[model samples]
Target: MKLLLSLSVIIGAIVMASTLTCNVCNFRFLFVCIGSSSTISCTGNCSLTQTFAGSAPFFSQQACDTNCVSNTTTQKENVFGLNYVKTCCSTDLCNSGNSAKLSLSLGLSMLLLWLLKCV
Candidate 1:
C-alpha cells in the first residue's frame, strides 16, 4: 500500500508538470529602400502579410512603396522529464529593403500547482 501511494504521488506530480499553457507574443520590423518591391521569407507560423504599393494618396506617383509578411512555425522537444512546445513566426515582409529573417518565440506550460494539489 505504501509503495502504491508513492507511485501515485509521483504520477500526479508528472501529470501536473505536463499540463498545457498558453502564451501571447507580438513583434515587428522595418525596411527602407528606393522602390516599393521586396521579398521576405520565413520558416514557421507564417501568418499575415501586408504590402504597400503605388504612391501615397498625398504623395507623387513616384513615391516609395511598402510590404509586410508574417508566418508561424511550431516544434516540440522534451527535457529533464518536461515537455516543451516551441512556436515561431514573422510579422511582415518589406519591399525594396534589405532581406530579413524573423524567428518566433517558444512557450512552456505551467503545471506545478496542479501536481501539488493531486498530492
Candidate 2:
C-alpha cells in the first residue's frame, strides 16, 4: 500500500508538472460590427468608374476587417482603424511565459500535497 501510494504521488507530480508547463490558448465566437464612412466621390475618365466621396480610410477598414472575423461576427462598439478593440480578451491559465510558470508551480505543489495524503 505504501509503495502504491508513493508511486501514485510520483506519477501525479510528474503528470501535473508536464501538463501545467504547456500553453493553451482558446478562442470563442463573439458578435459583429457594421460601420460605414462618408461617401467619397472620385473622378475618372471612364463614366463607369465609381468614386467614394468620404470612404473610410485604409487603417479604419483594416481594423474593421481584423475584428470582423465573419459575417455573423459583431461587437458592441464599431472601432475604426487600429484605434482599439472593444472585444473582450483576457489571458488565463497558459497566457504569457511568467503566468504559465506560476501556474505550473502551484499545480506541482498541489500534486505533492495530494501525493502525501496517498502515502
> What TM-score against the true fold does each predicted structure earn?
0.22, 0.21
lDDT of 1: 0.30
- What digit string (tens of lDDT, one per residue) describes model 1 on residues 1-119? 99999999999887666432211112223321212322333322233222222221111111111221232222223342322222223333211223233332211112355566788
Tens-digit lDDT track of model 2 for 41-60: 12111011111223421111
Query: What's model 2's TM-score?
Result: 0.21
Clashes of 1: 19
Report RMSD for candidate 2.
26.2
